[model samples]
Target: MKRVWGSFFLAMSEAIVPLERIHSLIVVLRGQRVILDRDLADLYGVTTKRLNEQVKRNRRKFPEDFMLQLTGEEKDKVVANCDHLRNLRFSPVSPYAFTEHGTVQAANVLNSDAACDMSVQVVRAFVALRHMMINHKALSVKLAELDARIGMHDEQIGEIVKTIRQLAAPEGPRHRRKIGFHPGNR
Candidate 1:
């Protein structure tokens, strides 16, 4: 059961981002390492401003942890890291911040049944992906250990082969064995 889950986890990690994008209806709503308002809007098929408006309207649903505005420095960093954001035309003066749940909350605020369903599915996929990443990291560590052991075994095997070759080599002069012929009797 554990192994099955681990395998499923690994597969999910490899697949999450790609699958999320394919669903198109479900956006990542986050940046490389952080969730930004613009991303949420893009995923929810709303303007960035509209997304913020919905959050503002339902302020109680989102505390600081659930949603916040991105700091200038964070926004700048995001722009720096993201090629799409590098262009001035698409870049916003400010961006909002939200956790995964914030986006889910946005779905509710929008009151769209489709968005709600997509959000739930996306969240589940993300969770599975996270599990897979953890499993992959563990497997990578194990693989490193196995590689080291295999390298050591290869060296040991080489030494053994060398030793066997030395033993097989004729070290001393070979004496011919004399066999008496029974030709006369025959």
Candidate 2:
């Protein structure tokens, strides 16, 4: 029983790391969210070479939309922007970038218990990130609408202030009413 419990705790701890690490691995390439092959390998507890081998074996499963090999320029850009990828800067081969679906497919091809477990967390992280982006976009739209409304009100407010100032100002010297009755006027 103790051994079983120990393994369960160990698995849980291992699973916890994937959720956190996978989120950090996610990057934007060509405006699409993707994870690099090296990063995915690290997450799956495999070597880059092994991971690439599996991907190569299952080439038909990964369509263009699912996976793409980063160009030299793109690879350089990734290395430049991401400090964690500094080691990859000297790598002989440019890394293959996998979209959300591709990452899932890789997990299926790897066919290891760890890969399957981590894949679930990876997918969860992607979904969470997507939801956050959607919410941010909606909030931005609402803010823009509020800004437009405020701009319209600014002109109206200025006009109201001008009218109030005009009403409050003394137009000219006020004519005094006669204290006594004026015979001519009567």
Candidate 3:
């Protein structure tokens, strides 16, 4: 029984989330890309009810900026964008949505040593993910600049080839030709 429980705990711990998912998670949260409570619960490996309970239990920690209940319009927009959500005929009455900032704040709100530790790890992962995104954006801009320069060089080469072709062609009408142009003879 102890072994089984330990294995369960280990599995839950392993499911916390990898760093790569943090960026997408932030986008879903802050970008108003709505992920339902049920979906979030699955991702976090917690029951939806339990997740809501946790949030309710620490309501004071979550400011309006950190978390907000989704408005009807927002929910409708989400449903429209997601084919999977088409079956959701009604908006969730009390579904709480956490923004990226809110999720970070949540780490501090939960009243447990484990929660605190997990929050710290999650926050660090978020920071690393944010840095990676910024770096990727910078690299993309640099690559675009390089591409533009290469295009310009290609145009210049084409122009040089055209000029060379023109110079090599016979200088006049078909019957006309230049004669005896030599270095030593005027």
Candidate 3, residue 97: the lDDT equals 70
Q: Kindly indicate the candidate among 1 and 2 with the higher TM-score.
A: 2
TM-score, candidate 1, is 0.61
Question: Could you tell which candidate, 1 or 3, scores higher by lDDT?
Answer: 1
Residue range with the least summed lDDT across 10 consecutive positions in model 3: 1-10
lDDT of 3 by residue, 112-151 (tens): 4544544555566666766877999999999999999999
Q: How would you encode candidate 2's per-residue C-alpha lDDT over 40-115 as one tens digit per residue?
A: 8877767778899999999999999999999999999999998989998999898999999999999999988788
Residue 98's C-alpha lDDT in candidate 1? 61
Q: What stretches of model 1 exceed 4 Å from their correct place?
A: 1-34, 87-92, 161-186
What's model 2's TM-score?
0.83
Q: Which ten residues in a row have the lowest lDDT in candidate 2?
A: 1-10
- Candidate 1, residue 137: Cα displacement in angstroms equals 2.1
Better of 2 and 3 by TM-score: 2
Q: Over the stretch 73-92, how does candidate 1's per-residue lDDT look in tens digits?
A: 76676676665566623564
By TM-score, the best candidate is: 2
